[model samples]
Target: MSKIVMFDMDGTLLDLSFDDFIWNECLPERHAKIHQLPLSESKEKLYQFYQSHRHTLVWYSSTYWTKTVGVDVLKLQQEFQSKIQARSGCIELLQQLKEQGYICWLVTNADRASLRLKLDNIAIEHFFDVIISSEQVGYAKEDINFWQELQRLHPFNPDETIFIDDTATVLKTAEKFGIQHLFNISQPSSLKDIKQHQDLEFKTLDRLTELLSILNEIDRKDNDVKIA
Candidate 1:
Protein backbone atom coordinates (compact mmCIF):
# COMPACT_ATOMS: atom_id res chain seq x y z
CA MET A 1 0.00 0.00 0.00
CA SER A 2 1.17 3.52 -0.73
CA LYS A 3 1.78 5.91 2.13
CA ILE A 4 -0.96 8.08 3.62
CA VAL A 5 -1.29 11.72 2.59
CA MET A 6 -3.33 14.35 4.44
CA PHE A 7 -5.10 17.16 2.62
CA ASP A 8 -6.28 20.50 3.96
CA MET A 9 -9.54 21.32 2.24
CA ASP A 10 -10.47 24.98 2.17
CA GLY A 11 -7.52 26.86 0.81
CA THR A 12 -5.77 23.75 -0.40
CA LEU A 13 -8.25 21.96 -2.62
CA LEU A 14 -11.46 23.97 -2.45
CA ASP A 15 -11.19 27.33 -4.17
CA LEU A 16 -10.59 30.03 -1.58
CA SER A 17 -12.91 32.51 -3.32
CA PHE A 18 -15.70 29.94 -3.03
CA ASP A 19 -15.70 30.69 0.72
CA ASP A 20 -16.57 34.35 0.17
CA PHE A 21 -19.09 33.33 -2.44
CA ILE A 22 -20.90 30.92 -0.11
CA TRP A 23 -20.92 33.07 3.01
CA ASN A 24 -21.67 36.20 1.04
CA GLU A 25 -24.04 34.88 -1.62
CA CYS A 26 -25.30 31.28 -1.58
CA LEU A 27 -25.86 31.02 2.16
CA PRO A 28 -27.48 34.38 2.63
CA GLU A 29 -29.65 33.73 -0.40
CA ARG A 30 -31.15 30.80 1.50
CA HIS A 31 -31.03 32.43 4.93
CA ALA A 32 -32.98 35.47 3.87
CA LYS A 33 -35.80 33.27 2.65
CA ILE A 34 -35.99 31.44 5.95
CA HIS A 35 -35.76 34.54 8.12
CA GLN A 36 -37.84 36.78 5.86
CA LEU A 37 -35.19 39.46 5.91
CA PRO A 38 -33.81 41.49 3.05
CA LEU A 39 -31.06 39.68 1.24
CA SER A 40 -28.61 42.49 1.85
CA GLU A 41 -29.42 42.65 5.55
CA SER A 42 -29.18 38.90 5.94
CA LYS A 43 -25.87 38.77 4.15
CA GLU A 44 -24.47 41.52 6.33
CA LYS A 45 -25.63 39.84 9.50
CA LEU A 46 -24.21 36.48 8.52
CA TYR A 47 -20.90 38.02 7.58
CA GLN A 48 -20.66 39.93 10.83
CA PHE A 49 -21.62 36.87 12.85
CA TYR A 50 -19.11 34.67 11.05
CA GLN A 51 -16.26 37.14 11.52
CA SER A 52 -16.60 36.84 15.27
CA HIS A 53 -16.53 33.03 15.33
CA ARG A 54 -14.68 31.88 12.24
CA HIS A 55 -12.05 29.97 14.23
CA THR A 56 -14.31 28.44 16.84
CA LEU A 57 -16.04 25.05 17.03
CA VAL A 58 -19.46 26.69 16.77
CA TRP A 59 -18.57 28.10 13.38
CA TYR A 60 -16.92 24.93 12.12
CA SER A 61 -19.71 22.44 12.74
CA SER A 62 -23.42 21.84 13.46
CA THR A 63 -23.24 23.25 16.97
CA TYR A 64 -23.88 26.72 15.62
CA TRP A 65 -26.79 25.52 13.51
CA THR A 66 -28.51 23.71 16.38
CA LYS A 67 -28.00 26.46 18.94
CA THR A 68 -28.25 29.61 16.86
CA VAL A 69 -29.84 28.94 13.46
CA GLY A 70 -33.23 28.01 15.00
CA VAL A 71 -33.94 25.17 12.60
CA ASP A 72 -33.58 21.46 12.25
CA VAL A 73 -29.81 20.91 12.36
CA LEU A 74 -29.70 18.25 9.68
CA LYS A 75 -32.04 20.21 7.46
CA LEU A 76 -29.93 23.33 7.76
CA GLN A 77 -26.83 21.29 7.00
CA GLN A 78 -28.47 19.81 3.91
CA GLU A 79 -29.40 23.33 2.89
CA PHE A 80 -25.85 24.55 3.35
CA GLN A 81 -24.46 21.47 1.62
CA SER A 82 -26.42 22.42 -1.45
CA LYS A 83 -24.46 25.64 -1.61
CA ILE A 84 -20.65 25.28 -1.82
CA GLN A 85 -18.40 22.33 -2.56
CA ALA A 86 -14.92 21.39 -3.65
CA ARG A 87 -13.44 23.26 -6.58
CA SER A 88 -12.97 21.94 -10.09
CA GLY A 89 -10.84 18.80 -10.22
CA CYS A 90 -11.30 18.16 -6.49
CA ILE A 91 -12.76 14.71 -7.00
CA GLU A 92 -10.39 14.04 -9.81
CA LEU A 93 -7.48 14.97 -7.61
CA LEU A 94 -8.50 12.57 -4.89
CA GLN A 95 -9.32 9.88 -7.36
CA GLN A 96 -5.97 10.25 -9.00
CA LEU A 97 -4.20 9.95 -5.66
CA LYS A 98 -6.25 6.92 -4.76
CA GLU A 99 -5.46 5.30 -8.07
CA GLN A 100 -1.81 5.97 -7.41
CA GLY A 101 -2.21 3.73 -4.34
CA TYR A 102 -2.06 6.48 -1.75
CA ILE A 103 -4.30 6.61 1.30
CA CYS A 104 -5.75 10.10 1.39
CA TRP A 105 -7.28 11.71 4.47
CA LEU A 106 -8.73 15.15 5.00
CA VAL A 107 -6.97 16.77 7.93
CA THR A 108 -8.43 20.15 8.63
CA ASN A 109 -8.70 22.71 11.40
CA ALA A 110 -12.36 23.26 10.54
CA ASP A 111 -14.94 22.28 13.12
CA ARG A 112 -16.57 18.96 12.28
CA ALA A 113 -19.88 20.58 11.33
CA SER A 114 -18.50 23.08 8.84
CA LEU A 115 -16.19 20.51 7.30
CA ARG A 116 -18.99 17.96 6.94
CA LEU A 117 -21.15 20.57 5.23
CA LYS A 118 -18.47 21.25 2.65
CA LEU A 119 -17.72 17.57 2.12
CA ASP A 120 -21.38 16.63 1.70
CA ASN A 121 -21.95 19.46 -0.76
CA ILE A 122 -19.13 18.04 -2.85
CA ALA A 123 -20.63 14.57 -2.55
CA ILE A 124 -17.15 13.12 -2.23
CA GLU A 125 -17.44 12.35 1.45
CA HIS A 126 -16.17 8.84 0.87
CA PHE A 127 -12.97 9.96 -0.76
CA PHE A 128 -11.27 10.23 2.60
CA ASP A 129 -10.53 7.21 4.75
CA VAL A 130 -10.86 9.56 7.71
CA ILE A 131 -11.80 13.17 8.34
CA ILE A 132 -9.68 14.51 11.18
CA SER A 133 -11.08 17.64 12.76
CA SER A 134 -9.33 19.72 15.40
CA GLU A 135 -12.67 20.34 17.10
CA GLN A 136 -12.87 16.72 18.26
CA VAL A 137 -9.53 16.99 19.99
CA GLY A 138 -10.29 20.46 21.45
CA TYR A 139 -7.27 21.99 19.84
CA ALA A 140 -6.85 23.68 16.52
CA LYS A 141 -3.87 23.11 14.22
CA GLU A 142 -1.94 25.63 16.26
CA ASP A 143 -1.73 23.06 19.04
CA ILE A 144 0.27 19.87 18.64
CA ASN A 145 -2.32 17.95 20.69
CA PHE A 146 -4.41 17.73 17.57
CA TRP A 147 -1.52 16.08 15.78
CA GLN A 148 -0.86 13.82 18.75
CA GLU A 149 -4.45 12.64 18.75
CA LEU A 150 -4.22 11.98 15.03
CA GLN A 151 -0.98 10.10 15.48
CA ARG A 152 -2.57 7.93 18.12
CA LEU A 153 -5.54 7.14 15.92
CA HIS A 154 -3.45 6.36 12.83
CA PRO A 155 0.23 6.05 13.14
CA PHE A 156 2.13 7.15 10.06
CA ASN A 157 5.83 7.61 9.98
CA PRO A 158 6.58 11.31 10.01
CA ASP A 159 8.73 10.80 6.94
CA GLU A 160 5.70 9.43 5.19
CA THR A 161 2.59 11.45 6.21
CA ILE A 162 2.44 14.28 3.71
CA PHE A 163 0.48 17.42 4.64
CA ILE A 164 -0.73 19.84 1.98
CA ASP A 165 -2.06 23.14 3.28
CA ASP A 166 -2.41 26.82 2.43
CA THR A 167 -1.52 28.12 5.87
CA ALA A 168 2.09 28.70 6.84
CA THR A 169 1.40 28.43 10.55
CA VAL A 170 -0.11 24.97 10.32
CA LEU A 171 2.58 24.02 7.88
CA LYS A 172 5.21 24.98 10.41
CA THR A 173 3.41 23.22 13.22
CA ALA A 174 3.02 20.07 11.15
CA GLU A 175 6.69 20.23 10.42
CA LYS A 176 7.40 20.51 14.12
CA PHE A 177 5.13 17.54 14.84
CA GLY A 178 7.33 15.48 12.52
CA ILE A 179 5.17 15.28 9.42
CA GLN A 180 8.01 15.01 6.94
CA HIS A 181 6.37 16.35 3.82
CA LEU A 182 4.46 19.65 3.79
CA PHE A 183 3.37 21.58 0.69
CA ASN A 184 2.00 25.06 0.83
CA ILE A 185 -0.64 25.84 -1.78
CA SER A 186 0.70 27.53 -4.82
CA GLN A 187 -1.13 30.68 -3.82
CA PRO A 188 -0.97 33.53 -1.39
CA SER A 189 -0.97 32.26 2.19
CA SER A 190 -4.41 32.67 3.73
CA LEU A 191 -3.90 32.19 7.48
CA LYS A 192 -1.14 34.70 7.94
CA ASP A 193 1.52 36.55 6.00
CA ILE A 194 4.55 34.66 7.18
CA LYS A 195 7.65 32.99 5.82
CA GLN A 196 7.82 29.20 5.61
CA HIS A 197 10.47 26.56 6.21
CA GLN A 198 9.50 24.38 3.28
CA ASP A 199 11.03 25.05 -0.09
CA LEU A 200 8.32 23.32 -2.13
CA GLU A 201 5.23 25.52 -2.64
CA PHE A 202 2.50 26.25 -5.19
CA LYS A 203 0.84 29.41 -6.48
CA THR A 204 -2.75 28.48 -7.33
CA LEU A 205 -4.22 25.00 -7.75
CA ASP A 206 -5.67 25.50 -11.18
CA ARG A 207 -4.68 21.93 -11.99
CA LEU A 208 -3.95 19.59 -9.15
CA THR A 209 -3.35 17.37 -12.14
CA GLU A 210 0.25 18.07 -11.30
CA LEU A 211 0.12 16.25 -7.94
CA LEU A 212 1.12 12.89 -9.37
CA SER A 213 4.33 14.36 -10.62
CA ILE A 214 4.97 16.07 -7.30
CA LEU A 215 4.41 12.85 -5.40
CA ASN A 216 7.00 11.02 -7.43
CA GLU A 217 9.38 13.82 -6.58
CA ILE A 218 8.93 13.26 -2.84
CA ASP A 219 12.04 11.08 -3.19
CA ARG A 220 11.13 9.40 0.11
CA LYS A 221 13.95 11.68 1.17
CA ASP A 222 14.94 11.62 4.78
CA ASN A 223 13.82 14.42 7.14
CA ASP A 224 17.23 16.07 6.98
CA VAL A 225 16.54 17.56 3.55
CA LYS A 226 15.92 21.27 4.09
CA ILE A 227 13.94 23.59 1.84
CA ALA A 228 15.97 24.37 -1.24
Candidate 2:
Protein backbone atom coordinates (compact mmCIF):
# COMPACT_ATOMS: atom_id res chain seq x y z
CA MET A 1 0.00 0.00 0.00
CA SER A 2 1.11 3.54 -0.68
CA LYS A 3 2.06 5.76 2.25
CA ILE A 4 -0.86 8.11 2.74
CA VAL A 5 -1.48 10.96 5.14
CA MET A 6 -5.06 12.00 5.84
CA PHE A 7 -5.78 15.23 7.68
CA ASP A 8 -8.88 16.70 9.21
CA MET A 9 -9.52 20.05 7.59
CA ASP A 10 -11.19 22.28 10.16
CA GLY A 11 -8.75 22.19 13.06
CA THR A 12 -5.82 20.23 11.69
CA LEU A 13 -4.97 21.30 8.15
CA LEU A 14 -6.76 24.59 8.46
CA ASP A 15 -7.08 26.58 11.69
CA LEU A 16 -8.52 25.48 14.96
CA SER A 17 -12.06 26.75 15.71
CA PHE A 18 -15.65 26.09 14.76
CA ASP A 19 -15.69 28.76 12.04
CA ASP A 20 -18.20 30.85 13.94
CA PHE A 21 -16.69 33.92 12.33
CA ILE A 22 -19.43 34.06 9.72
CA TRP A 23 -22.28 33.36 12.12
CA ASN A 24 -20.77 35.62 14.78
CA GLU A 25 -19.79 38.57 12.63
CA CYS A 26 -21.10 38.53 9.08
CA LEU A 27 -24.43 36.72 8.95
CA PRO A 28 -25.98 38.24 12.02
CA GLU A 29 -24.55 41.65 11.21
CA ARG A 30 -26.02 41.49 7.72
CA HIS A 31 -29.35 40.22 8.98
CA ALA A 32 -29.56 42.94 11.60
CA LYS A 33 -28.75 45.61 9.03
CA ILE A 34 -31.21 44.30 6.49
CA HIS A 35 -34.04 43.51 8.92
CA GLN A 36 -33.72 46.78 10.86
CA LEU A 37 -33.11 45.05 14.20
CA PRO A 38 -30.97 46.92 16.71
CA LEU A 39 -27.43 46.15 15.45
CA SER A 40 -26.15 45.39 18.93
CA GLU A 41 -29.29 43.47 19.93
CA SER A 42 -29.39 41.59 16.64
CA LYS A 43 -25.71 40.74 16.73
CA GLU A 44 -26.04 39.63 20.33
CA LYS A 45 -29.15 37.55 19.84
CA LEU A 46 -28.02 36.02 16.58
CA TYR A 47 -24.64 35.19 18.04
CA GLN A 48 -26.26 33.61 21.08
CA PHE A 49 -28.68 31.64 18.93
CA TYR A 50 -25.81 30.43 16.80
CA GLN A 51 -23.96 29.33 19.88
CA SER A 52 -27.02 27.42 21.08
CA HIS A 53 -27.13 25.33 17.94
CA ARG A 54 -23.39 24.96 17.46
CA HIS A 55 -22.34 22.01 15.24
CA THR A 56 -25.71 22.04 13.53
CA LEU A 57 -27.54 23.29 10.49
CA VAL A 58 -30.73 23.34 12.57
CA TRP A 59 -30.33 27.07 13.16
CA TYR A 60 -28.72 27.92 9.86
CA SER A 61 -31.22 26.25 7.56
CA SER A 62 -34.62 27.27 6.18
CA THR A 63 -36.20 24.95 8.69
CA TYR A 64 -34.90 27.22 11.41
CA TRP A 65 -32.79 30.32 10.69
CA THR A 66 -35.03 31.45 7.86
CA LYS A 67 -37.92 31.81 10.28
CA THR A 68 -35.98 32.85 13.37
CA VAL A 69 -33.33 35.05 11.78
CA GLY A 70 -35.45 36.27 8.83
CA VAL A 71 -32.88 35.71 6.06
CA ASP A 72 -32.50 33.55 3.00
CA VAL A 73 -30.21 30.54 3.33
CA LEU A 74 -28.73 31.17 -0.10
CA LYS A 75 -28.02 34.75 0.78
CA LEU A 76 -26.56 33.87 4.17
CA GLN A 77 -24.37 31.17 2.65
CA GLN A 78 -23.15 33.71 0.11
CA GLU A 79 -22.40 36.13 2.92
CA PHE A 80 -20.54 33.38 4.80
CA GLN A 81 -18.46 32.56 1.76
CA SER A 82 -17.38 36.19 1.76
CA LYS A 83 -15.54 35.85 5.09
CA ILE A 84 -14.19 32.26 4.94
CA GLN A 85 -10.66 32.30 6.33
CA ALA A 86 -10.76 33.32 9.98
CA ARG A 87 -7.19 32.10 10.73
CA SER A 88 -3.98 31.03 9.01
CA GLY A 89 -0.64 29.01 8.57
CA CYS A 90 -2.03 25.64 7.41
CA ILE A 91 -1.82 26.38 3.73
CA GLU A 92 1.97 26.58 3.93
CA LEU A 93 2.12 23.20 5.66
CA LEU A 94 -0.09 21.70 2.99
CA GLN A 95 2.21 23.07 0.30
CA GLN A 96 5.27 21.64 1.96
CA LEU A 97 3.69 18.18 2.30
CA LYS A 98 2.52 18.18 -1.32
CA GLU A 99 6.07 18.91 -2.50
CA GLN A 100 7.26 15.96 -0.43
CA GLY A 101 6.42 12.43 -1.58
CA TYR A 102 3.48 11.93 0.77
CA ILE A 103 0.07 11.48 -0.85
CA CYS A 104 -1.99 13.93 1.16
CA TRP A 105 -5.76 13.87 1.55
CA LEU A 106 -8.40 15.73 3.55
CA VAL A 107 -11.16 14.16 5.60
CA THR A 108 -13.55 16.64 7.16
CA ASN A 109 -16.97 17.10 8.71
CA ALA A 110 -17.79 20.27 6.81
CA ASP A 111 -20.56 19.84 4.27
CA ARG A 112 -19.70 19.77 0.60
CA ALA A 113 -20.84 23.25 -0.34
CA SER A 114 -19.16 24.87 2.64
CA LEU A 115 -16.08 22.75 2.06
CA ARG A 116 -15.93 23.85 -1.57
CA LEU A 117 -16.31 27.49 -0.60
CA LYS A 118 -13.45 27.26 1.90
CA LEU A 119 -11.14 25.38 -0.45
CA ASP A 120 -11.99 27.65 -3.36
CA ASN A 121 -11.39 30.81 -1.35
CA ILE A 122 -8.05 29.48 -0.14
CA ALA A 123 -7.14 28.26 -3.67
CA ILE A 124 -5.66 25.14 -2.13
CA GLU A 125 -7.82 22.53 -3.83
CA HIS A 126 -5.06 21.03 -5.94
CA PHE A 127 -3.05 19.79 -2.99
CA PHE A 128 -5.45 17.07 -1.86
CA ASP A 129 -5.91 13.82 -3.74
CA VAL A 130 -9.45 13.60 -2.37
CA ILE A 131 -11.70 15.45 0.04
CA ILE A 132 -14.22 13.37 1.94
CA SER A 133 -16.70 14.82 4.38
CA SER A 134 -18.78 13.13 7.06
CA GLU A 135 -21.97 14.38 5.47
CA GLN A 136 -21.23 12.37 2.35
CA VAL A 137 -20.31 9.35 4.39
CA GLY A 138 -23.61 9.60 6.31
CA TYR A 139 -21.81 9.49 9.63
CA ALA A 140 -19.62 11.61 11.84
CA LYS A 141 -15.93 10.86 12.22
CA GLU A 142 -16.76 9.25 15.55
CA ASP A 143 -18.05 6.15 13.77
CA ILE A 144 -15.74 3.42 12.50
CA ASN A 145 -18.01 3.09 9.47
CA PHE A 146 -16.94 6.52 8.27
CA TRP A 147 -13.33 5.37 8.01
CA GLN A 148 -14.33 1.96 6.69
CA GLU A 149 -16.00 3.83 3.86
CA LEU A 150 -12.86 5.91 3.45
CA GLN A 151 -10.89 2.72 3.01
CA ARG A 152 -13.44 1.48 0.48
CA LEU A 153 -12.83 4.53 -1.65
CA HIS A 154 -9.08 5.07 -1.20
CA PRO A 155 -7.87 1.53 -0.41
CA PHE A 156 -4.96 2.48 1.85
CA ASN A 157 -3.77 0.09 4.52
CA PRO A 158 -4.01 1.30 8.09
CA ASP A 159 -0.39 0.50 8.80
CA GLU A 160 0.83 2.80 6.03
CA THR A 161 -1.57 5.62 6.85
CA ILE A 162 -1.47 8.36 9.45
CA PHE A 163 -4.68 10.17 10.32
CA ILE A 164 -4.66 13.52 12.07
CA ASP A 165 -7.50 15.36 13.67
CA ASP A 166 -8.31 17.50 16.71
CA THR A 167 -10.80 15.25 18.44
CA ALA A 168 -9.87 12.27 20.62
CA THR A 169 -13.29 10.77 20.14
CA VAL A 170 -12.78 10.56 16.43
CA LEU A 171 -9.19 9.42 16.85
CA LYS A 172 -10.42 6.54 18.98
CA THR A 173 -12.96 5.73 16.33
CA ALA A 174 -10.11 5.65 13.84
CA GLU A 175 -8.22 3.21 16.03
CA LYS A 176 -11.30 1.05 16.22
CA PHE A 177 -11.34 1.01 12.44
CA GLY A 178 -7.78 -0.40 12.60
CA ILE A 179 -5.89 2.81 11.92
CA GLN A 180 -2.99 2.44 14.35
CA HIS A 181 -1.43 5.70 13.21
CA LEU A 182 -3.04 8.88 14.47
CA PHE A 183 -2.24 12.37 15.72
CA ASN A 184 -4.39 14.69 17.76
CA ILE A 185 -3.49 18.25 16.93
CA SER A 186 -1.07 19.92 19.35
CA GLN A 187 -2.85 23.27 19.71
CA PRO A 188 -3.85 23.74 23.35
CA SER A 189 -7.44 24.63 22.60
CA SER A 190 -7.68 21.77 20.13
CA LEU A 191 -5.52 19.45 22.22
CA LYS A 192 -6.84 15.97 23.06
CA ASP A 193 -3.97 14.39 25.07
CA ILE A 194 -2.88 12.14 22.21
CA LYS A 195 0.62 11.45 23.57
CA GLN A 196 -0.02 7.96 24.98
CA HIS A 197 -1.30 6.68 21.63
CA GLN A 198 0.38 8.79 18.94
CA ASP A 199 3.55 8.41 16.98
CA LEU A 200 4.10 12.16 17.10
CA GLU A 201 2.25 15.07 18.66
CA PHE A 202 3.81 18.50 18.26
CA LYS A 203 2.21 21.90 18.67
CA THR A 204 4.36 23.90 16.30
CA LEU A 205 7.01 23.06 13.74
CA ASP A 206 9.68 25.23 12.21
CA ARG A 207 9.11 23.46 8.92
CA LEU A 208 7.44 20.46 7.29
CA THR A 209 10.83 19.95 5.71
CA GLU A 210 11.95 18.55 9.04
CA LEU A 211 9.23 15.89 8.90
CA LEU A 212 10.22 15.01 5.37
CA SER A 213 13.86 14.64 6.39
CA ILE A 214 12.95 12.21 9.17
CA LEU A 215 10.76 10.15 6.84
CA ASN A 216 13.58 9.96 4.32
CA GLU A 217 16.00 8.71 6.93
CA ILE A 218 13.56 6.01 8.01
CA ASP A 219 13.08 4.89 4.42
CA ARG A 220 16.84 4.72 3.91
CA LYS A 221 17.36 2.71 7.09
CA ASP A 222 14.56 0.31 6.23
CA ASN A 223 16.09 -0.32 2.81
CA ASP A 224 19.54 -1.11 4.24
CA VAL A 225 20.20 -4.81 4.81
CA LYS A 226 21.39 -6.28 8.16
CA ILE A 227 23.72 -9.27 8.53
CA ALA A 228 22.15 -12.14 10.41
Please give each candidate's TM-score.
0.69, 0.66
Residue 57 CA error for candidate 2 (Å)?
9.4
Q: Looking at model 1, which ten-residue stretch has the lowest summed lDDT?
A: 188-197
Residue-wise lDDT of candidate 2 within 1-228, one digit each (tens)? 346878787666654333545555666677888888887888888768877875443532343666677766445656656555523456666677777667888888776666776787767778888888777776677777788887887788886676777666778788888875666655522323423434444222333233455556645654673331
Per-residue lDDT over 28-87 for candidate 1, one digit per residue giving the tens place of the 0 to 100 score: 776888789898998788788887876454665556654665444545445645545465
Candidate 1 Cα errors over 4 Å, as ranges: 25-59, 65-77, 187-206, 220-228
The list of candidate 2 runs beyond 4 A from truth reads: 24-74, 80-82, 86-89, 188-228
**C-alpha displacement of 2 in model 2, angstroms?**
3.2
Model 2 gets an lDDT of 0.65
Clashing residue pairs in candidate 2 are none
Candidate 2, residue 123: lDDT: 74
Candidate 1 clashes: the total is 7
The per-prediction tally of clashing pairs is 7, 0
